[model samples]
Target chain A: MTAKPKLAVWKFSSCDGCQLSLLDCEDELLAVAGAVEIAYFLEASRAVTSGPYDLSLVEGSITTPHDAERIRKVRRQSRTLITIGACATAGGIQALKNFANVQSFIRSVYPHPEFIDTLATSTAIKDHVPVDFELRGCPISKHQLLELVSAVLNLRKPVIPTASQCLECKRAGTVCVMVASGTPCLGPVTQAGCGNLCPAHDRGCYGCFGPAEAPNTASLAQHLAVLGQSRRDIELAFRSFNANAEAFRREGNAHERE
Target chain B: MASKTPAPADRAGVIARAALDELVALLAGRGYRVIGPQLRDGAIVYDDLARADQLPAGWIDQQEGGSYRLVRGPDAALFGHVVGPHSWKRFLYPPAQKLWQAERSAGGFTVTTAAEPEPPLAFLGVRACELHAIAIQDRVFGVESGDFTDSGYAARRQAALLVAVNCGRAAGTCFCVSMQTGPKVTEDLAYDLVLTELLDDRRHDFLVTAGTARGAELLAGLPQRPASAADLVEAEAASARAAVQSRAMVPGVADLLRQNLEHRHWDAVAERCLGCANCTMVCPTCFCSTVEDVTDLSGDHAERWRKWDSCYTLEFSYIHGGGVRRETAARYRQWITHKLSSWHDQFGSSGCTGCGRCITWCPVGIDITAEARAIRDAEGS
Candidate 1:
């Protein structure tokens, strides 16, 4: 019998919600355990037997000097590294510091500002190390994570779609929040995932899944203005969870307080 | 079972407001899954109807570019709302369908085509524009028009009944008057049954017309009175009122767009176009699709499925090297031009029915009629 492939789950500066998505697999987690050896998942197993993992599921952004250094070692140890969630893929909400003064933020929020140790800007894993694949969403969707794991095990390209959220909304029969209600929605510029939760519930998308494939953010920003959103409001919307994602960051900067 | 005395084509009659329920029961009893519009989550959406009461009898939809709202009508009139985001194509062509399923056997893989007959569908309250949209799809999918027929689409489409309604009211986005597609169901359009709701202070009834033999067969079973001269006049007036709606397309947009291929107006439109695929997804006649092949974890079972694809996406134009229409400008140009111009050369008719779904459902409210006019009235191309 062939040896089970080694799988490792790693975290750098994330909320660990993405790792929980893997555990949230439940029955699928059992199937995954049977397929691969859980080599060094600190969240699930204490037993660490790992030199080179066949696959690595990474969560969180590189928010510290240590994270930047540590990610390279992870990339070296892993055959294929898949970054999960918005933080690992887009720098998450913490990347909001990229636009403003991080030092001033530290001084205001922390009493001992000198003791704080963090990078000036929280950056995605791809910024430091090459990523084989990326799973989008604030906390990665469980079904997509399973598809990624299955695709990796089967030696095929993952079937995660890069289509805009508008496609998903249309497929799900959810009315377009922006079109039907004149509410400013990011579905047109955002990637499809999260299962149409916001739009189906009559709320506009919060862009939890980051920018879509070839997103026309400039066009979307102009329409947002027409929808009665101020420049600051449009900026804040783009600057939310995916503040550092290139397409989003560029549009967000375009509408900055100036 | 009711006697099958097929009434002559275009035979008009009046069905009372209360007899609408009987019609639903009759269709249901005839083993057709009757789908009709009803208020859902503050918008009129089509769904399975157990009773005619489920129809949004007194509700009306106010639709403009980037805005839609549902409110109660001044009077109780069934089929008051215009088309919402849900097009009848969703039921006919379907968003996703399994083409084939493969199973791994000990000897070899056994494959079964996914053409299992679907339940017969009866669509109620189909707008006049929608009837035209369905006929357009008929040309796209029917064996008589296309070289290769989509068996799956053919099966569902053939085994369905289209109950259309002449528009008594039109949304601000509607331009059917210019397209010559609707506000009235013409004799050429293939609809089983068509209804014209009559709502005055004294009368609450529908002027019904059967366009097909089966429609006549179904209508003969239901309780209705012969259409009086006054009832016919009222029905004609109702449709005329809707046809006078202000939003309209230019007389020769197809030729205008062909002449102004390099017009900078496309770039202007692209500046506001989101390229989100919402317009195509909601469009009744946009029939592009992409397929996916997936297997289970065991690798024993595999299935190939097709889902609706849009020209606005980069992947839709993807080739061996890269996407041809990488810029949103190029993609938008391809979509609108092909919809209004190239489609006529390919299908002998315009792809758009001027349903105004593309306008009202656009995130930016990009009106095709206005864009066509801009291209036509350009200072210099």
Candidate 2:
């Protein structure tokens, strides 16, 4: 038998929910453990293993100067680097800081502002280093995370859906919250996954999975305005978990000025 | 089967609206899994029903482009509302289904084909336009077509029973009148039974007509009253009033779309189009699907599954190096052209049933009818 692939899980800055998703794959986690050598995953193990890792599952954004530099070294050492979840792929909720003054925020939130070292903007892994693939969500889904791992190990393209969330909602038989009861939903612009949860519960999607393939955020913003959403409401909606994603950032910026 | 001259026009009778429960019981007893419309997730959606009371009895939907609202209806009419987003196609060709499962067996592998068997279905409250959509799908999925057919779809569609409900009032988005498909379930369409709900201050009843011999047999077993000439007149008036369609499809759309293949209006539509697959997912007639093959982590088991796919997605058109239609403009053009123009070349009939679902369910409220007209008007200009 060939050598088991070396897998590494890296974190820069995040709540670590995305890393938890891999651990959440209870049955699949055991199988994954047997299939590959988990060289590094501080979330599950602390015994440090040095890279070059065969596959690096990166979580979180480049929030600090150190992290921006650290990602470059990680990328150089790994054969295939996949950024998982919105934080690593689209800058996560921490990227809300991208819009405002980071120094002022530090002064307000911390007692010793000088000790808090951070960058002016919370940015994605791709902003610093080239990403081979991005598996998106606020905290990435367990199934998608597994598919990404399996596909990467086997040298195949992951079967992750890049279509808008509306496809899954319709397939799950959830009525359109936007059309059905005039709810302002981001499902039209958001990527599929997250189990199509929001609309199933009668609430609008908060766009945790970020922009889907060829998302026309401008068109959706206009539709949201027609649905009676305020420009600020529209801005905030797009500036959620996946705020710093390219398509969503541009849309939120478009609304913010107005 | 369509050649068996149209159904008897005047062969109808009246049954109290509450008698639908008895009919449900009868169908359920006959090993058919009965399904009907119910108020679910703020809209009327097709779901499993054991009793007719599960129907959206006193609710009506006010639907328009990108909007739908379920309001308390004026009266106690079961089939008061027109078709909602959920259509009969979901049951016939489900969104996702396992095609085959393979398991490791002694040095080789053994494969089990087809998903688990489902009982025959009985769909209640099927609108006339919906019936037309089903007939269109039959040509694509059933043995009725001379060429390729899905064996599973053919089997499920053949065994399913349709109990259609004629429209008494049209929704603002309805254009079935222009499509020449609805306001009434005309003969030549396959349905076990057809009903036109009649509501008044004095009584609430349905004028039921049997389209097939099975429908006649079921009607014979049910409690019903021979229709009075007045009842017949009222039923005719009800369907006639439903012909008041607020939207209409332009005639010769197949030719017009073909002529305007490079029309600039498509660019205007792409500007508003989200490229979301909502319209195709809601459309009863859109039948494109893609397959996926997966293996367990142990590599002991593998399976193939088919899921509904739409042309709006770049992946749907992707081949080899990259996606064929890279721009949103091209994808939108491809969808409309296939649905309107090339569909005729393929299917010998229009693919659209004028259900107006695509219009109402679009995120940006892009009207297909209005788009077609814009292109048609641009021709003269």
Among all windows of 10 consecutive residues in model 2 chain B, the one with the lowest summed lDDT is: B1-10
How do the residues B1-381 of candidate 1 rate in per-residue lDDT, one tens digit apiece? 111244443478899988889988989998999999987776787788999899887888887777788888888888878888898899988898898999999989999997775679999899888988887887888735456788777777878888889989888889988888988988777788888999999989999888787888777988988898888899989998888776898887788778878889988988888889999999999999988777765567778889998998888877999999988889888998899999999889999888898988888888888888888888375
Model 1: what is its DockQ? 0.67
For residue A232, what is the lDDT in candidate 1? 95
* Candidate 2, B282-381: lDDT as tens digits: 9999999988877766667778889999999989988999999988889888888888889889887888988899988997888889989999999845
lDDT of each: 0.87, 0.88
Give the residue spans of candidate 2 off by over 4 A.
B1-6, B104-108
Interface RMSD of each: 1.4, 1.2
Clashing pairs in 1: none
Candidate 1 global CA lDDT score: 0.87
